[model samples]
Target: MMSKLLKNRYLILRRIVQITILALYFGANAYGWKVLVGNLSYSKFLQAIPLADPFTVLQMLAAGAVVGVDVLVGAVVIAVFYGLIGGRAFCSWVCPINMVTDLANWLRRKLKIDRDARRINISRRFRYWALGTLLVVSFVVGAAAYEFVNPIGFFVRGLLFSIGFGWTLILAIFLFDLLILKHGWCGYICPVGATYSLIGSKSLIRVEHNHLNCTNCGNCKEVCPEKQVLNPVIYRKSGFINGIECTNCGRCIEVCNDNALKFSIRSFLKNN
Candidate 1:
């Protein structure tokens, strides 16, 4: 067990962080912790500071800037956090839906399901279209209308309130990932993910591939939710993963037997 853990430290750490975040919200709701309130869309910290999704704020700005001061500040704080750390981290390390999707992926593999054979042939460009649609709908409705159908909202509300309808949506996501698509929601569909990727385009921390030790074994690609980002970087065609969509989830790092991949400031890696 100790040997297995030492090899997969980052994966274990990410799981812990995800669980703790959910637990905090549940505690605040059930026991009045008051340290953090609200879900991923908009949240209060210490009952004073704010942390919010910048994309949601963007929709609010588009519709009308008739929002609260705390909301704006919260969006900025979140933007900075993602900008420094890389945005897709939000998808893998923070989003509650990730837990469901990951489990689906694991189960699909275990059951010997053909991931590519079952997926719908939807354009990956749809995420951008969906992002645009979300903003337009918000502008038309004068509110963050997407939140009503947002799985993230459903997941959080289910945790705080009752599973009710949310469990249905959650189960659908699990099934979608398990049987219909591999990495369907986050990689191909989510507007929140698209927005965060845009915000973290020039993030400081990123995955750096040292081609010297790389073996071209493709273990990293097998595990990556965003494998497209790894090919250029790992093959030495690019200095590092430049794609904004790279989530910095560190799965590639943990699975790399050659120890060629690592997390570092993008500039430092390039300079050396």
Candidate 2:
């Protein structure tokens, strides 16, 4: 039953759309395409009539020109599409690097060597602290700091530089993902994930567990990539959400045989 639902047409379509967008993004970045369809650029083109490259927006935003039309437009698009639809849906399903990470995770699971289940003793509070530090650094040192830690940027650079030269460091991260980690870069590191997680907290769409129907079967916890759903702080709803680490990948929902979870949207103003 779980497998059938996981293989549902909607999920398959979602995955296809995500992969298509990610491929276009990679092509635009690597091949210097003037126009790409079904991506942020396409939407930007429709809005502005003369599409601005993402690099230009990145530069202007980095220089503290946040009030410009370009910045505003970009922010709205990112927030509405990526943040509101599903947190890090872009990262989980639409990122080329994330595709690679998923592939690695699959191999690790097949090998029975996955270590992502190991509980780290690090304070959950540290995620918030790290988020704060990234925001401050982005303001102070600029997007360069954020870019350095962004998996998207890292993957693009790795593809360009490391793939050609066969760099050991790049290969190591790839191998680490395949051997010891399950979306490790995403769950533990990836500043872009951190950024998206923050933006997505107040997003309209969110996952809700129907505790009344829940059997406490722990299936959701077992398959959750973020593993936060298992934490009492979040599971018990000690707060709106315990942390911003959730990617909203829907794997938990897919794994729950009891159909105890669902994603629904809420108005930000009304909820607040």
Flag regions of model 1 displaced more than 4 Å. Answer: 268-272
Question: lDDT per model, in order?
Answer: 0.83, 0.57
Identify the runs in model 2 with alpha carbons over 4 angstroms from their true place: 1-11, 26-72, 83-85, 114-143, 154-170, 180-182, 233-243, 267-272
Query: Best candidate per TM-score, number?
Result: 1
TM-score of each: 0.93, 0.69
Write candidate 1's Cα lDDT for 97-128 as tens digits: 98888899878878878735654777766788
lDDT of 1 at 147: 79
lDDT of candidate 2 over 16-109, digit per residue (tens) = 8666655655566678654552343223432343333233244346547554575556656666665566665655655556666666776776
Clash list (residue pairs), candidate 1: none
TM-score of 1: 0.93
For model 1, what is the error of residue 189's alpha carbon versus the real structure, in angstroms, after optimal superposition?
0.2
Candidate 2 colliding pairs: none
